[model samples]
Target chain A: MLIGRPSDITASEITPATVFRKRRALIKAAGLGTMMAWSGLSLGEEPKTKIQDYSKSSYGQEEKLTSYRDITTYNNFYEFGTGKEQPAENVGQFKTTPWTVSIEGEVLKPRKLGIEELMKLAPLEERIYRMRCVEGWSMVIPWVGIPLSSLVKLAQPTGNAKFVELISAADPATMPGVRAPILDWPYVEALRLDEAMHSLTILAVGLYGEILPAQNGAPVRLVVPWKYGFKGGKSIVRIRFVEKMPQTTWMRAAPREYGFYANVNPTVDHPRWSQASERRIGGNVFSRRTPTLMFNGYADQVAQLYAGMDLRKHF
Target chain B: MAPTSIAWIKRGIFLLALGPLIRLFWLGFTDQLGANPVEFIEHSTGTWALVALLLSLAVTPLRLLFNMGWLVSLRRMLGLFMFFYACLHFLAYLWLDHWFDWAGIGADIIKHPYVLVGFLALILSIPLAVTSTDAMIRKLKRRWKTLHLLAYPVAILGVLHYLWLVKKDISQPLIYALILFILLLIRLYYRLKLRRV
Candidate 1:
């Protein structure tokens, strides 16, 4: 839906070249001998440069530079204001220093993990991905985070841990949008354990290699690429493992409108708009409209997981 | 007041009526509307259309309730503004969202209930707008009044379209529905009063 020429994003402070060079330097400085060992063994006949190529592809091409910093910071969380830039301006009042993620329900530990402790569990890696908003606009963002599986493993999910529900902080004093009943405060997002373990699911801490801007979920947020952006709840404060499927914020607001599996499939049209195609963020205005892929183009890795299930029914 | 002064005031009012449309165009050109400029344009114009419709509906009630005869003069202008915004809204959806894919858009209208209602509301507004001029109003007098009655149904359909569009959080839509219901009730009361008289 974004019309007119794209903004001159060339002035972006976080360039792809800088991120690539930094990643290579980080890999070398870490003395990741284990990574080298795995890289050599996993790729039998493939050249050593193949792994670099794979990383490059994931990082995104330098030519197109389709990736961008996730604009959740410029979010209309609505409690703050209706403007997209309001959250970034107003969310500074929120204090994330004393933040703690409450892990409970089906987890064995059932304790709170401080933000610093959580960060120490796994080294952060930047993953550049195309983020499509249901509103039809999109962004390519380089997010810094560890896989959700890493955090789930730290808590030690019990056999009963079937679903993971994430809850955002709900203090109206900070998140003014919480004052209104636009949605139940402390927004919640849930995913199945298998889906949580899918390497793509991340507990993001930063974007563009900088500490996350308060508007962009600040301390931590969920990043589920296969689903629409809303599935990735921002400003997260609590994470609970539950046996039964947890009630998500959007699903509770309108069950008919939002389904539990909010996957981005072009075939399944949103009741209001068709999902058949998406305008890539930084592509050519007229010729760049790309056909949206099923499972957000993660079909090769994730489609079989839902093998016999009816997508439309679930959707 | 002198005749020339009154004429100048009338011309000034006409330009004032053009304010929102000019602002919309300026915003579109400035790129201050956000990432999805087309969607922003569509939403802005659609919101303005709803506001104009509400304003137009208020005219009769204001005249009857407050005995303000001058309010009747503004009704046509408000209705025209609603039509103008509706045109921009439809154009944005057709050009940007559908990329002028007529077949796909036609299929969408048939398949999607929300799109169907939205398209129906838009189509119905066209006749009302076309018959809004003083000449057309006089030429088809009785038929013109009857055709403009379609605005009530179109407004209802417009609200329904909004309600169905949102995936979650019905608060905004519900507020609009409440306002529309009250506006319709006022009209119903006026109609009943006229019949009794």
Candidate 2:
């Protein structure tokens, strides 16, 4: 379930940011997991995430990365569990060392390739993007990955291929969260053919220059900066090209709340919460509730994708 | 009319009622209030409010079933505490979430049933808390008990508020609902017994 956002932080007497940082350093020295306790103080810990090694990059922006702790600890990976911390606590046991992703469906050449083989398909670059959650919280993340188009182009989609379905690997024993009837097991997400080939879409392998943490979809995950964060399928094991639009987990669970495009449209409010404003992670708890931007501040890059369509009804 | 023994028991109950507030402060001071501090505080206060309401409602049934007449002494404090925390929960919504966007909140009340029910539960509780004073209780006399009967419906609304709030996984709210059902059954059982006589 999507958790509630920052509430009543204005009057809160939380420790001052300077004092809180001193304690965080102490906690870190003591080898304690005080990340959640004072995560707000660490949001600005890594602000110099400007990557200099991009063979092919566009829309580069200077942004502050969420505290590594908050980014890693607060997750929505239900395959590990529903609670935000559950993924960080449980995903450590997940094996990403020997990872493989099979690219199949409506393609000239279908093949199963290891993680190493996939990484070599295109030049890797770092893209810092703003990820808005459907739950009214947002984050700025610097992702190390390559354009997903690099891989899709290699698979060689046939003329019939118009949509793409991504399946995240979920075994009952390994992903015990699936044992419970929370969401359909082996989480699935879809992208329109044009959307899949967009410059903004990529397959992420790491964050903050480090290999992706298990909780943050280690090995490989999809990053569509314009869409809500949930649309980014994590720990992907299968990529299939389909003719018709494919069904996604959140869209199937609550179609009214989630949509196929799942674009970060502030105008289309979610049934449960308004999407107009979002509290950025890592800022002082109260002063950070800023108005959410259309397509999460990426309208200039991707607005032409939906020129004349009604986002509200399709939302 | 209060005996020394009952007075001592009342003090114990009064202090016990302060436990949630004290615990919250301790957690806050120690920096232990998890990732979203405001949400954590909101949930904790809301949960305690519901628990207090259920406990206060249980007083009457326990008095008759176990012949423990002294339980009534604890009822007023428990009920007042429920109102206190309910106010905190609503404040969290207004201040933390909406930032005093009255027009926005008013629209929310119209669109979302959970917000409507929760707002109703909080509003209905105000009069009950104001009238809880011993002076008001004595002055109002027979009219007091009738007005206080509003507690039952208020409890029902609270349970419903919780039921609609969660998007999925209703386990936490289910326990509260079951207890409320049992309390209602006990009241009905007593009414039938009196009618038989």
Each prediction's DockQ? 0.17, 0.21
Segments in model 1 whose C-alpha atoms lie over 4 Å from true places? A1-57, A62-83, A281-289, B1-10, B167-179
Compose the digit string of candidate 1's lDDT tens values, residues B136-192.
989997888888899899889988988887655567778888888887788789999
- Kept native contacts, as fractions per model, are 0.16, 0.14
List pairs with backbone clashes in candidate 2.
A8-B96
Highest TM-score model number: 2
All candidates: TM-score: 0.82, 0.85
For B66-171, candidate 2 gives per-residue lDDT tens digits of 8888888889988998998898888877887678888888988877787788788888888899999989999999999999888988999999989887766577
For residues A1-315, what per-residue lDDT tens digits would candidate 2 score against the true structure?
A: 333232222212334334555776678787767655445433322222233444434444677767666677678888888877777666635788799999999999999989988877878787888888887788888788988999899999999999999999897777767788888777999899899999889999877666777779978999999999999999999999999998898888877778899889878777866788887776542543789999999899899999998998777
Best by DockQ: 2
User: Per-residue alpha-carbon lDDT of model 1 for A149-230, expressed as tens digits?
Assistant: 9889888989998999998888888777778777877788899889999988888887766666667786888888878888
Could you tell me which 10 consecutive residues in candidate 1 chain A have the lowest summed lDDT?
Answer: A45-54
Task: Provide the DockQ value for model 1.
Answer: 0.17
